[model samples]
Target: MSQLYVAVLAIIVAVLLAVALYRATRVKTKADYLVAGRSLPAAVLVLTLLTSWIGAGSLFAGAENAYKNGFAALWQPAGGWLGLLLIYFIAPRARKFAQFTLPDLLEARYNQTARVLGTLAILFAYVGITSYQFKGGGDVLHLIFPDTVSSQLGTYIIALFVIVTTALAGMSSVAYMDVAIGSLVTCICIISAPSLLHQAGGWSALHSSLPPQYFEIFGNYRLSPHGVLQSPAMGLVRALEFLVPTMLLMLGNQVMYQKFFSAKSERDARNSVIGWIIGTVVLETLIVAIAVFGRALYPTGEVAQHPREIIPYTARHGLPAILGAVLLGAVFAKVISTASNYLFSPATNLVNDVFVRYLAPNASNKRVLIVSRLAVVLLGCWALYQAIYAESILQKMLWAYTIYSAALTPVVLAAFYSKRVTAWGAVAAIASGTVVTLAWDLPGVKSLFPHIISDRDAIFPALFVAIAALIIVSLFTPAPSEAQLAQVAE
Candidate 1:
C-alpha cells in the first residue's frame, strides 16, 4: 500500500514537471517569466488563484484547526472569503495597474522607500509562508514512506523539487501547472469529504462521537500552546485571531495581485475573481469537513498527537487503497503547487524590485531571467532552513500572515482607495507594522508588557500602530500632488 501511494505521487509529480518543462520553453522574457506575458485567460487565472490561495496554509494549518476546533475552523478561511468580495472590485483595477510585482505598485503609489520597505516585509512574510509548504510536503512524504523517508529527509527532497520546478519556467509554468493540480485537488477533496463522512457513519455519528462544541459557531474551547484548554470566550478570541490575519493576507496578497496582472484583460481578471471566490469557499469548506470527519474516525493515536496530519493520515489509513493513494497524491501535489507559487513570488520581488530596479536596470531580458531563477534557488534554500527549525505549522502560518496583514494590507488597500495618503505616511506605516509584528513575538518584549501585549496576538497591536501611523501622519503631511494621486486613480 505504501508502494502504491509512492507510485501514484511519483506519477503526479512527473506529470507536473513535464508540464513545467514544456512551459519553460515559452518563457523567453521577464514578462513571460514573471506575469506569463500578461496573456493568461480567465480560466487559467481562476485555477491558479485557487491553487495559490489554498496550499499548506489550508491543507495543513487549517486542517489542524478543524481537527482541534471543528467547524469553527471556518473562521480562518472566512477572512479570505470576505476579502474576495472586495477583491472582485479591485481585480480589474489591479489588472489596469499591471506590473510584475507588488513592490512596483507600492513605488508608483508611494515612494522608493515604500517600495523597498514593502519588499522587505514581503520577503519576511512570504519566506515564512513558503517554509511551511516545504514542511507540509515533508509531512506528506513521511506519511507515505515513513521508514525510508524521515520527515527531515523528506523536507530536503520536497524543497529540491519545489525549487527545481519553480526555477524551470516561472509564472507561465506555475499558472498552467495549477490548472491540472487545482482540478485534481478540488475533485479529490469533494469526493473525499463525503466518503470520509460516510465512513464516520454520517453526521449523526459524528455528532455523537465528538463534543457538541465541535458543531458550534465559535467552538467551545481552544488548546493553548502548552496544551491547556481555555474557555469559550478564549475560543472566540482565537477565532478572531485566525479570521483577521487570513482576511488581511487575502486583501493584500501579492500572489493574487500578480495573477490579476497576468490576466489577458481587465474583464478576465474580474471574472476570475468570481470563480476564485466560489472555488475557494467550496474547497475550504470541504477541507474543514474532511478534517472533522477524519477526527471522528481516528479520535486518538499518532494523528491525535500531530493533528496537522489529519488529512494525509486519513488518506493513508481510512480510505480504500486506490482512493487513499490518489488523495495523498493530491495533498502532495497541492503542497508543491503552493510552494512553487510562494517561493516564486518572493524571488520575483528580489529580482524585479531590487536587482533590476537598482542593481542592473539596463540588464538584458536573458540576464534578468537568469537572475530570476537564481533568486528562486536562494530563497528556496532560505525557506528550507526555516522549515527545518519550525515547530507548529498553524502557529507559523499566523505569524507569517500577521506580518503581511498588519504591515502591508492597510497600505496596499490605501494605495487603491485613499488619495489623501502621503508617501511618508505609507513609509511610516510599513516600518511600524513590520517592527511591531516582529517584536511582538520576542520573549523579552512580551515579558515587559505581560498583560497588555502578551496575551494578544501580534496582529492587534501591529495593525493598530500601522493604521494610526498611516492616518495621523498623512493628516499632518501635505496631501499628494495631483500627479501622484493620478497614478493610482481609477
Candidate 2:
C-alpha cells in the first residue's frame, strides 16, 4: 500500500471522528446520549444503519470468502438481500411498537424478567461484535503500515477511538457520523466498482480465471476441506443463515429496530429500509467482486503475506491511487463506524436494562448518565483487549453472533409471533442458546463447524437448539397472560 494514500485516508477518518468527539455534550438526560432524543431524519437513519451493518463482516469476512471460494463468496451479500427483505416486512411493525431496545420489546410483550434476560443476551453479542470490529480495524492499520503499528496497538487505537466516540453524545453522534460516512462509501463504491471490474479484464476475462464451480451459489462448500458435500440436508445450514438469523433480526434484534423508533416518522422508517436494500445489494456486490477478481490478480498465500492488509493490497494495487484512497477509506470507515455504533450499545443496555432496572431503580437521571458513560469505558476496554488477543476477526464475529442470536432469537420470536411462550420459555431459550454457543467454541467443536462452514453459516445449529428448547419448555408449561399477547400485538 502507498504510504501517502494510507496516510491521507487515516487523516480523513481521524478528522471526522474528531469532529464527533467535539459534538458530544454533558448528558442532560439518558435520552440525549442514547437515541439523540428520537429525532433522526430519513437520510441519517439510512446512513447510520448502512454503516453500522457493513463493517468487518462485510469487508473482511466477505473478502476472505471471496479468496477461498471464488465467486461462491456471493453468499455473504445474498444473505444481506434476504435480511433486507426481512426488514421490509418487519420494520414497520417494529416502528409502530417502538421501544429503546430488543429487551424493551420483550418487556412490552412479556415482563421485567424478559427485559433483563434479553439485555444479557444482547450485551453478550454486543461485546463479541464490537470486539471483532476492533480486530478488523487493527488489521487495517497493520495492513496499511505493518512496520509501524503492532497489531495489538492497532487494535487498541481502533478500540480507543470507538470508545471515545461512543462515550460522547452516544447514538446522537453515531447517527450523524454514519450519515456522512455512509454517503461517502456508497458513492465511492458505485464509482469504483466498474473500474475494478474493468481492470480485472472485464466479466469474460474474470470468468476465465476461476473454475466453473465458483459461479454456483453454494458450490465448493462442503462439510469438510476434502470438498465433498455432507448431504443435501447439510446444505440446510447455509440456507438457515439467511433464513434463521433473518427471522431473529426481524423478530429479535433491537438495535436496528431502535433506529425505527428514532425515525422522524413511519414513512422515514420505510424509506430507510428501501435505501438499505438498494445500497446493500450494490455495495456488497462490488466488495465481493473486489475479492474475487483480486484473486485473479494475486490468488493464494497473499493473505498471510498481509492477511488483514490484503484488502488494501487489492485496492491499492488494483485501482488508481485516487480511487484506491476512496475505497480504502470506505473500508476503514466501515471498520470505525460499525464499531462505534455497537460499542455504545452494550453500555446503554448495561445501564438501562440491568443497572437502572435492578441496581438502583430510584437513581437520579444524573446518576444514570454517569453510569452509562462509565459502562461505555469499561465495556470498550474489555472488547478492545479481546479483539487484540483472543482470536482472529472471523472467530470473534461468529462467536458474538451465535451467542446473541441463539440466546435472543427464540425468545424474541415467541414475544412477537407466539404468545404461548412463558417466562420460563424465554429463560430456557436464552440459556440454551448461550450454553450451546459457548460449548460449540470448546476445542472439540471448533474443529468441526467454523473450518467447514464459516461462523456465518455455523451458528444455525445452536440457534435452532435454543429455539427448540424454548418451544419444548413452553409446551409443558402454562402460557403468558393475555396481557402479554396484547402488548406484542401492538
Candidate 3:
C-alpha cells in the first residue's frame, strides 16, 4: 500500500520534470530566463504566486501550528492576508517599475551600497527559506518510504531536483509547472478536508478531541518556557510576533515581485492579486482544517514529536490510497516549486545585481545566463548545507521573515512612496535592521543580553531600529533629487 503511494508520487514528479524539460527550450535570453521575458498572463501569475507563497512554510510549518492550536493558528496566515490587502495597491506599481530583482529596485531608488547590502540580506533570508523547503520535501519523502530513505538523504535528493529544474528553464519552468502543482494541491486539499472530517467523526468530534484553548484567538494561556502565566497583553504581543512576520514577508517578498515583473502587463500583475488572495485564504484554511482533523485521529506517536509531518501523515494513514497519493504528491510538488522560487531569487540577486551589474556589466546574454545557472548550483548547495542542521520550519520561517521585514521592507516601500527619503537613510535602515536581527539571534550576544530583548525574537527590535533610522536619517540628510525620485515613480 505504501509502495502504491510512492509510485503515484514518482509518476507526478516525472510528469513535472518532463514539462520543465519542454519549457527549458523557450528560455533563450537573460530576461527570458530571469522573468519569463515578462510574458506571463494574470492567470499564470496568480497560480505561481499561490504556489510559491504556500510552500513548506505554510504547508508544514503552518500545519504544525494548527495541529497544536487549532483555529487560532490562523494568526500566521492572517498576517499574510493583512499584507495582501496592501499588496493589492502595490502590485501594479511594482510591475510598472519592473526590474530583475529586489536589489535592482534598491539600486534604482537608493545607491550601489544599498543594492549590495540588500542582496546580502536577501541571500541570508532567502537561503534560510530555501533550506526549510528542502527539509520539508525530505520530510514528505521520509514519511512515504521511512525504511528506504533517511530524511537527510531525502533532503539532498530534493535539493538536486529543485536546483536542476530551476536552472533548466529558470522562471519559465517554475511558473508554468506551478500551474499544474497549484491546481492539484488546492483541489486535493479541499476534497480531502471533508473526507478527513467525516472519517474523524465530523466537526463536533474534532472540537471535543482538542483542548478548548485551541479554539481561542491566542489560545487560553500564554506561558513562558518556565511555565509562569503571562499577561494577556503580552500574549497578544506574542501573537503579533507570529502575525507580523508573515505580513512582512508577503510585503517584501522578492518572489512575489519577480512574478509580478514576469506578468505581461501591470494590469495582469494587479489582477492576479485577486486570485492569489482567494486561493491563499481557501487553501491555507483547508490546510489548517486538514491538520486539525488529522490531530483528532492521530493524536499521539511520531506526529507529536514532529508536528510538521501531520499533513503528510494524515494523507498516508487517514485517507484512502488514491486520495492519499494525490495529496502527498501535491504537497511534494509545492515544496519543490517554492524551493525553486526561493533558490532562484537569490541566484538572480547574486548574478544580475552583483555579478553582472558590478563584475561583468558588459557581459553578453549568453555569459549572463551561464553565470545565472552557476549561481543556482552554488546557492542550492549552501541551502542544502543548512538543511543538514535543520530545525523547526516555523522557527526558521519567522527568523527569515524578521530579517526581510525589518531590514528591507521599510526601505523598499519608501522607495515607491516617498521622494523625501535619502539614499543614506535607506542604507542606515538596511544596515541597522540586518545587524540588529543577526546580533539579537547570535548565541554569544544573546547570552550576554537581558531577557527583555534577547528572549524576544528579532522582529520588534530590528523593525524599530530600521524604521527609526529610515525616518530620522532621511529627515537629517538631503532628500533625493527629482531624477532619483522619478526612477522609482515611473
Q: What is the TM-score (0 to 1) of candidate 2? A: 0.91
Per-residue lDDT of model 3, residues 1-490, tens digit only: 8778878888888988997899888888999999999999999999999999999998899999888777778888999999999999999989998889988889888999999999999999999999999999999999988999988889989999999999998999999989999999999988999999999997688788888777777763365757676787877888888899889889999999999999999999999999999999999999988988888898999998999999999998999999998899999999999999999999999999888888999999899889999999999999999988978888888889999999999998898888899999999999999999989867788678867765478899899999999999999998888888888775
Question: Which whole-number lDDT from 0 to 100 does residue 250 have in model 3?
Answer: 93
Q: Candidate 1 has which clashing residue pairs, if any?
A: none
The total number of steric clashes, by the backbone 3 Å criterion, in model 3 comes to 0
Clash number by candidate, in order? 0, 0, 0
What TM-score would each prediction reach against the true structure?
Answer: 0.98, 0.91, 0.98
The C-alpha lDDT values of all candidates are 0.93, 0.73, 0.91
Cα error, residue 113 of model 2, in Å, equals 3.0
Q: Give the per-residue lDDT digits (tens) of candidate 1, residues 1-490.
A: 7779869987998899899999999999999999999999999999999999999999999999999889999999999999999999999889999988999999998989999999999999999999999999999999988889988899999999999999999999999889999999999988888889889998899999999989988874466666687887887887898899999999999999999989999999999999999999999999999999999999999999999999999999988899889999999999999999999999999999999999999999999999999999999999999999998999899999999999999999999999899999999999999999999978899789987675578998899999999999999999888877777788
lDDT of 3 at 189: 89
What global local distance difference test value does model 1 have?
A: 0.93
